[model samples]
Target: ELLLTTYAFCYHFQSDDPLIKLVEDYKWIDFFDFHWRLGIDGLSLGPILLTGLITTLATLVAWPVTRDSRLFHFFMLAMYSGQIGSFSSRDLLLFFIIWEYQWNLIIHT
Candidate 1:
């Protein structure tokens, strides 16, 4: 994950324009619009890289965990993904969803 984050950082640095990797919309209600969009740019890449670093270090330091270690790691990775999503999401709804999920995961853990 850290390696991937580093690669993304390098890729973003090499690119002159913001990268919008994905854009998809899911309509569940007529009144609301939910777009699942993701991108990486100068502003967002920093947080993504930081999150990747911190999560990697956390996983390493949590090596001694014995009780429900698998579940713990699962949640950790989920939270990490949420963090990444929140950072990269280009849509307001997507960001909100990811943010709420991260908070819920943190509360549960």
Candidate 2:
């Protein structure tokens, strides 16, 4: 994403020709198909953020009750990594992998 942002800015600032207009024409929405547009939206971003926050807060709240707070910390960290992975995943299979990554955390907790 950093590289992409850098490249985008490079094109926007360094080029002024009309032909350059064609290079950065794609919208973020274009990444998804028409069918996906029905399901994915700004509204969905809110819930994903909310759910991620809830999981993080729950883990923090459970710190004292967990038998070994150290182990809980490890598993919670794993979960946090997974949630971030899922948040950024564009491929369905990659998203599934991210979702599954939290299973062990569930079992351990």
Candidate 3:
């Protein structure tokens, strides 16, 4: 799934352009007047791709491990999701939330 998604993103990615905004909504936040925003650019693309590739490879490599495998994969995928979220997030609060979520997943995993 990740590989295919990454491939699609790469196919559509344009390095010379600024970030592409995927979402923007002020209605989701009522306090501090912040909007929920998400975007991706060349600056963030590297980390996003790296995170996806590494997580996918790690999952493949760890496939033979049978000790609490489900839990391990769950946390791993959760961490990856948080990382992707952080990379794409255009809002400070959302980035921080994802950062903390990734940290917590790391601790629990």
Q: List the residue pairs that clash in candidate 3.
A: none
Candidate 1 lDDT by residue in tens digits, 1-109: 9997787567545446665543344554556654556777668767888999999999999999999999989988998999988888877777888899889888876
Query: Residue 71 error for model 2, in Å?
Result: 0.8
Candidate 2, lDDT over the whole model:
0.51
**Following a full C-alpha superposition, what root-mean-square deviation does model 3 have from the true structure?**
2.1
Put down candidate 3 lDDT per residue, 60-107, tens digits, no spaces: 999998999888888887888888889988888888888998898778
Q: Considering every candidate listed, which one attains the maximal lDDT?
A: 1
> Which residue pairs show collisions in model 2?
none
Each model's total of backbone clashes? 0, 0, 0
Q: Where's the lowest-lDDT run of ten residues in candidate 2? A: 34-43
Better of 1 and 2 by lDDT: 1
What does the lDDT come to for candidate 1? 0.79
The lDDT of each candidate is: 0.79, 0.51, 0.79
- Estimate the TM-score for candidate 1: 0.80
Number of the top candidate by TM-score? Answer: 3
The positional error of residue 51 in candidate 2, measured at the CA in angstroms, is: 2.7
